[model samples]
Target chain A: MGLLSLLSGLCRWNNNDEENSAARSFILSSVLWLAFVVSLALILATKFVWPDFLGGTAWLSFGRLRPLHVNGALFGWLSMSSTGIMLYILPRLTGVRLYSERLGNLTCLLWNLLLIGASITLPLGYTQGREYAEFILPLDYLFMSILALLGYNVFKTVARMKDKAMYVSLWYFLGSLVWMPFTYMVGNNFLMDTTGLGGRGPVPGVNDAMLNWWYGHNIIGMWFSTLGLGIFYYFLPVLTKNPLYSHRLSLIGFWTLAFFYVWNGQHHLIYGPGPDWLEDVAITFSVLMLIPVFAVVYNFFKTAQGSWHLMFDNSPEHLPVRFFMIGGLAYFLTCTQGPFQALKAVNSNLHLSYWVVAHAHLAFLATFSFISMASIYYVLPRLLNTSINLRLAHWHFWLLCLGLIIFLGILHTAGIVQGAMWLVKLEEYDFVTGSALFKPAVEFIDIVRLLHPFYFTLWLGAGLMATGVMLFVVNVLLTFYKADSPGGRLRSKGA
Target chain B: MYTALILFILAGSIICLGGIYYKRSIVLGILVPGAMLLIIIAFLSTAVLPYMEKIPATDKGVPYSERALLGRQIYVREGCWYCHTQQVRPIRTDAGLGNVSQPGDYQYDYPHVLGTERTGPDLSHLGGKYEDDWHRNHLMNPRPKTPEEEGMAGKVKGSVMPPFSYLSREETEALVTYLQSLR
Candidate 1:
């Protein structure tokens, strides 16, 4: 009788009113960080246009602040919020409460601490000095530990799932966790001999470069892309009230993505110093990446076939759907740009130029960030059982879209001009004359001067984006105040 | 290295099989194993094989001196590599930067600083391009401090490279040493 009772208790459905405090806390914290980091980014943009805006402060200097800004946006904002979304979605899809809300909340606490540690240490000139892998050794260990715990929590929850059929979203979430720890370990040069091998740190020389980009691009491909895509899959079905386009298509996309994205790192080294075959592998796989990207995008569009018109509805309740559609379009564009730029002909001119920076933002800010915003807006109200202000949500959407369009437009133009101007200085030889050839062109300095106007406008667009984020934070906080009343539940339900 | 790869595949397969047996889910078994194989193969082809390749240093490739090493640390700490790329390609745009780089050229760069952007300029062959005094002043203020300083590569009017005047003299010297040692 005791054993039977225990089994029955385990299988019991959680009350609909059960407080999901872990997801709620994580979403709130992520919003605050988003506001903070966007403000930091706006400052960075200002410094680009006016270099002397905040000159002479060591901590506030561009180099130090640059790393902090990147880490903040990536780990602080995106990773934390994605984890929150995953935790929330896991229980709903699996038909059980999270295995341990206590552990989930603990993960959130530790993640915030890790970000705080990075914020303090990176600005204080303590870092490992690699891009995207700059956190000190101790922080790396802390992050990995937290990740392991989170993975265990997720797997435990999935093990007890009431539903027998595994969802596509679950595949992405689980696969992402499996890939991340190894990717982080190898990329950060952890768990290896640090002082051996020519004393150039773990994984020496050009191999370190290969390892770095492998880690770097995969952090995007494996972690962020997977998580964001999973969230996209979850929200698409929920918002549109449609079944997934095809289960087979989703699996094909996942497998192809896992295979091809890993081979793409060396494309960053094209025309540089890696072996020829390595570069060829990178290029070929990078192009092949289109298969998975197209598959996922097609699945998304097909699922939203009848619901496409719903995106035009700007009501507060409908904002999440709009965000998802626009974000989906941005994902398609970002992936198309990825394969296009990976080509050697385009890469030779555009590599190490502002074009790449534009591409990074298109992926991070426009695609994943937008998808994240949609997830947060959709999930937060449902978790809180309170509705947010419609006007504020509208403002947030339009302002951010306008700002991103302006910001990306200026950057793309600047990159092309920069590339063409650099090419004008290229040394040419005429075989007929058997002598050096030269052509008149504007100086590199002249090009820098010409870009000043564009940089100023870029800063302005960033300011607008920052304002939109601040409004979002305000609306979310206001929702919390309204959460306590019985009327709040009714309002949300009515919406 | 080979043992490590074999061990990883073995361990991963066991784990997947265990999960499959416990959950009775063949999909998890297949999917997890497939992902494991693909990532390992990718890692082997890109990182492990490259690390094991035998490439002797070119004539221009040499190890760093102790001071230059210290400078490399300072260069990294200040994140100068964020703006400046260290590799010169054979493309037309990089025609006059220097000799096109080789795999052996980076034999001593443990944590390679082949940066991904040219917000400033490529620094692959920046060594001896200008006087030490020019470097000092340029580091102090990337923009020209005087008319004579105008029209230089990084000292142009609108250059956005941040001033490193906050760095101690020793740190600055070490960083400059590292920069000058690049060639």
Candidate 2:
């Protein structure tokens, strides 16, 4: 009976008219995660240990490693995880067999390949010279193609849905499917950079800034946040066995965030070389962004109201949901602090400090960790057709949360140290090039910074984070084998 | 101090007002004070403003520092702010770039382009740190710029600053004009 139940959970969702084929989605997901782990090991090794590599090339310096790490986590890990969830999620949400299994398989294969290109070309010194748009232009074209295919499949699935509600996940899924391409095109200058879609001249910095930010911030909002939000909407209620506190609030949070999130990316540029008004606008939205963030977090937390135990020791199936919970909170904290940091006065000091890096990682990795972990918990057991070992799942949860605190805490405190020291220094004629003021800060925070400031501490934090990720990767692999429960079987026909 | 009080209260109130607040965000309500704390910090920011150093009005022409400020404008327009910081910190703090950035140096800075992220190095005190030739080489091809390769000091340090071959000589000169103007 348990075996049959497991099978139904695994294959039934994909094939009634069709077989349990989107199986490639499972392979894609596993391979993507495996690839991410392996690549991360190399990247981290280079940054932490192999102080000298690439035969003394300029591009391989640690200055560039920052972007590489971000790309790996965001594009490599987070993007694939979201796609994997969509394999099951889109079908289940839409209540229909995938429109084309072959197409789905192709898209998954091409998407990972394109990501591979981004990793290779970017590190090999081929890049577009923009922050997020670093992958050379052709790689971007490959990305856009994957998005287009995914869009087609999803639209076809939506057309077939029996459920009229278009559950919020579909709304968000479709939103991502639409918005990212638009964001990419403008940011990548897709037409102009290629076939000359628009006339070019002194590409207005403000215009480019706005466009880059619009795309950058939206990825956080429409892609990762929306997906993360959808996961919360589905899993929180299921785990707690409670009706979502208010679908009304959920809708409000969703749309408000959609508008606000895109604008907030500008906050990253405040006190920058941008104009005064631009900084003002960035600061304003940085503050205004609080609305949607609060809405999502409050609503999610509120849903767990009375069923506090559900949040406690529970089925292994729910650990990822707990991650989403904490991730939602971290998002709120990060966003709240984000606007404050954007303010001119504070920004004057905090702009180039580790504090910003801490926040950036907290915001990105927090949401990434939450959503990715939740996706794994929600789907992996089902994918493997077995219940996860609850104890192992709990270990994964603690390690991740603790590691985040260690990582983020160190960065945040280090950032403050960096910011304060900067402010205390001379800026004009008397200014000498030295880290004197900053030295005391590093010393004061030595317990926190632990050792010398700069690369070592950063590598340490990233190291702990890598360890946590390794733990998670192991747990997911172990789930491939069956648990000794009724939930272990994979066929409803009862072999 | 008020900022501390407000933050404490703000954090405390969030804990106090636990549980669902509907479409009405209790968190944003708390965030209002966070904004207030920012205003307070900005008020205290006057300390840095006074330290901004003025150009000595060069006999060669319109104080090249002003031109450097112009170059900084280009830096901003180009989204260099997205990756690099201009502000330097005080003391031996590990981050304010390797120097204690001075207030006098930024007096003329209208928008104060000190950035927050180290997607690149803090440029608070990049003045006289490089020569025209070195800056040219780095800007033309960051891929080849040596980044001082190793060690703490080099007469002509290597760097990973991107190539600005896209800019004309005048534009590049203007940029160099502005960069050299940095204290």
Candidate 3:
């Protein structure tokens, strides 16, 4: 009953003209939760180097803790934060108030409930045994409902738009909303038994893999990537005081991305048992993705042509712009690396190595997380009606950047070395003779040992990144409370 | 190939032009139907059609028993797939990992566990590679045994795998059963 009253109180806002209190609260909570989970995940990652750091606990074992970390970061952190940002942006873009802030607040509450449930359930060993789609059936249903609620709210707002022309960001936002629920259903095989559909039994093994990757890649591509790009489109112009360069280019990028990314999932199974043609199709589409990537890259860079100087202004107001610029550059690099790695030769060496891990981080952390941070910075001041601490924000940005570079640099090197050694070892063994190709100069254990120093480097980088996240959280909290104080109330930019 | 490409182009065209050309029905007519069709086609080609072609006449190998299935659950619970890949590719680097994985080999997998990493070696053909006793010893402590121990010589000396000694005996046994059933 107390919980119910608290939730009702949260939804009851006094001033509801333009400021989205519910959305702002959701974004703040999501960012804080993200920081917490990311720190825990990184600490758990250190167990790789120091196995016995906290090894004895059953629930705290690397296996259970790792999934919690992955799911927590993906769903709890990135997805929730993205949804909160979308809520804030949608009303402003449409030039209308949100359809229902009360509904939005309720959704936020339920979303947090689901996240908490997942954090508890996953550690307790209840899972469906799928990466990214690991949440059991019940939780999956809850997520679908959340998506439906969000989609309803956003579409309702769009329906009441004061502006007739659909902006590029709105298009991407709409596409993501359409894409995510279906992708989740297909990837998780949720519709199979319920509809009594044809091919209703469990998805065949190889085919399940294909379906999983399709869902996995599209989640990143359609949901996070598109949403991040949409946020970028909205914020870039606002920050730069410049119009978007080539609106046509933005449309082309969106279309190409939607068409191509779904097919790229099979690239993950390149040398696995999938049909040759399927692999070829995946590779072809992955390479074709270069079109959209280059278009988006050109659009962003050209838009920032004159406004690049703002990034160097060293003002708190410009810090978010700096993040957007750096994230845009990282997005460009990540896409380039993605297509290159999708090639069979490169994949053979890098597929299962730490190279893929590095790529995932570059996409998830460097590109999307950075963009989300910028969005928060851009929107937070407007929502709170006050500025953040410039000094602390600067510290957050540099520390994160430095940490990512070190982490990626070390992992990529380790992956290449491991891949090369594996190849050499394989070549030495004669398949027909079933004997040593040559007396192996080093064993696989030697390769494992070789990676220890790199793992230590990763730990150090993660520590630095965690510190940066804490600083960001603290700065945001202090600014928030300071603005809420009685003395600061006089300066409040209230609706 | 042509069909897939045409479908791809059609999907892209609908997504791009749907909102701009016909704003009235964009959400219900174009966006919903177009996205749904794309998903259907993707599933048809990649999953359903592939299954029709690849379904085995009879089960391959022994089906995972209840115990092994429970062990598989433990594997998933622990996130073992994060480091250890279950699929062996047909490349030189995968030569020592045993036979290249086949679709039929994973016939019983509900949510397929053909993992993507090899932080440890491929486990697709791990069955019978070593004794159950060896697995128990290795799981408890990955350090190589002394030369005085039987069959200890020439084994890989150092390993980065964390001990699962904390796992209850039943859990460990079940996990071992699942590992042995992989081949």
- Leading candidate by lDDT: 1
Model 1 TM-score (2 dp) = 0.90
Could you tell me the lDDT of residue B9 within candidate 3?
52
Sort every candidate by DockQ, greatest first: 3, 1, 2
> Fnat per model, in the order given?
0.56, 0.08, 0.51
Candidate 1 or 3, higher DockQ? 3
Task: Tell me how many residue pairs clash in candidate 1.
Answer: 0
Off by over 4 Å in 1: A1-19, A192-199, A426-442, A484-495, B1-25, B145-155
In order, what lDDT does every prediction score? 0.80, 0.56, 0.76
Stronger candidate by lDDT (1 vs 2)? 1
User: Against the hidden true structure, what lDDT does model 3 obtain?
Assistant: 0.76
The residue pairs in collision within model 1 are: none
True contacts kept of 1: 0.56
Per-residue lDDT value at A342 in model 1: 90
- Residues B47-164 of candidate 3: C-alpha lDDT, one tens digit per residue: 5545566555334434688888778767766778878888878887777666667777766665677888878877887887788888877777566546654355223455777667
Q: After superposition, how far is residue A22 of candidate 3 from its true place, in Å?
A: 2.6
RMSD of 1: 6.8
What's the TM-score of each model vs. the native?
0.90, 0.69, 0.90
